[model samples]
Target: MIAQVKLAFGIAAGFGLGALTVQALHAQAGPPAYVISEITVTDADAYNREYVPLANRALAESGQRRLASGGRTVALAGEPPASRIVVSVFENLEKARAAYSSPDYLAARAIGDRYGRLRIFAVEGLAQ
Candidate 1:
């Protein structure tokens, strides 16, 4: 009976340690990052024609998932948003930064700048 008790205790301790290890690994992995862009298009036709496709392709190639784009935003507590808003999610903050500064995105931005005003930023999301 004593031997059985010891074995059960040992098994419980092992499982506890395993659970703790998994939690530690998950904590270190961190949370996702979000990129938000607020755009006010001066010439919609030109912006869509020259900038949209290139920017979309660049972002998609960089492993970003578009969460929201050009949706109606009703401001609840602050100033109204720009004419268009785009939100994207990346694996992490590092990847978000990389995607924004990449050559392809930069090139697309160069074209986008000609037809619109853009404000872009990234924020770290809460861990799930």
Candidate 2:
């Protein structure tokens, strides 16, 4: 009673399911540790070479750390003057503090603060 396509799909799915191992459910070696989400002032301008480069470098370093640590990611963005820069570095409190202490991040934070920082905060997150 099954159409050819339906029958073929059923057999394929059954075989696929049967072949799946526990490894499938545990694709990643472990859960992610943390994530950092950053939003800069909306009025940010790429023309500001000094600021732009610092931002670029910060994101680059954060990205590398993310990959090597096998946890979360750091994402950065620029908003308008009316908007504010928001950065959330998710991880163990100690690790997050350590990241902030890094010279590179410190420099970027200085630049970002000059732009805007209305109601910014860091909180705990269950990395996954």
Candidate 3:
């Protein structure tokens, strides 16, 4: 029984140490970056047909994870949001900026602009 207890404790300690090491490594890597886009569509059909798919592909190819897209939003305080809101996460601030300025994204944005007005910005997320 004592030997089993010791073995269990050793395994638990090993897992705890491994978790700590991972946290430490992640801390060194810095927090992730998030991109928020507020869009007002002038032509819904055109925006959905032309802009959304292309933008989705570009962002996906750039390693972005879409967190929220056109969901029902309640304003807790301040003014309400635009007609559409999209939130995405990237590995880092530099990666977020790169993704925004990439040729694929730019091409998609060109098409998007014709059908909608967009306000987009990036912010660094809290460190884990």
Candidate 4:
């Protein structure tokens, strides 16, 4: 519950600021792009299977617009910093944060506790 709240806040605050930053820097051609890696650490494939579908449903429901190319990911194998499911996205920091709000993202996150310690991080200043 606590982690979910933090994730929600992170998305709202991070993206709100990121959007503002983009607007402030509108002089640039476009929003500074980032390669977002929505990842989770897990040792069990069962966890991955369960989480991915739920998270996908949430993502489909939210409809948060992302300049991003693809979608979210679920942990496939191993453990944190080792095994992970990485999804790709191209959006400002604000959008990055917002993506977490996706039912897909949140659902996936919830199942995280079913496994070992799990987490998701947005890689700032990334590409591809």
TM-score of each: 0.80, 0.39, 0.81, 0.45
Please give, for residues 21-128, the per-residue lDDT of candidate 2 as tens digits.
555755533443344444444445632444556755764655324322213434456642323332444335555555656788678767766664423334565534
Among these predictions, the greatest lDDT belongs to 1
lDDT of 4 by residue, 1-128 (tens): 99999999999999999999987666453443343343344456766677656765655554433343224434467643334434444345566667676656766767866764544555555332
TM-score of 1: 0.80
Off by over 4 Å in 4: 1-43, 60-80, 85-87, 102-104, 126-128
Q: Best candidate, TM-score-wise?
A: 3
**How much RMSD separates candidate 4 from the native structure?**
17.7
lDDT of each: 0.96, 0.51, 0.93, 0.56
Model 3 lDDT tens row, 1-128: 99999999999999999999998898888889999999999999999999999988988988899999999977789998899999999988999999999999999999999999999999999877
- Candidate 1, backbone clash total: 0
The runs of at least 3 residues in candidate 1 whose Cα sits more than 4 Å from the true structure, single-residue gaps closed, are: 1-25
Q: What is the C-alpha RMSD of each candidate to the true structure, in Å?
A: 3.5, 10.5, 3.1, 17.7
- Model 3 Cα RMSD, 1 decimal: 3.1
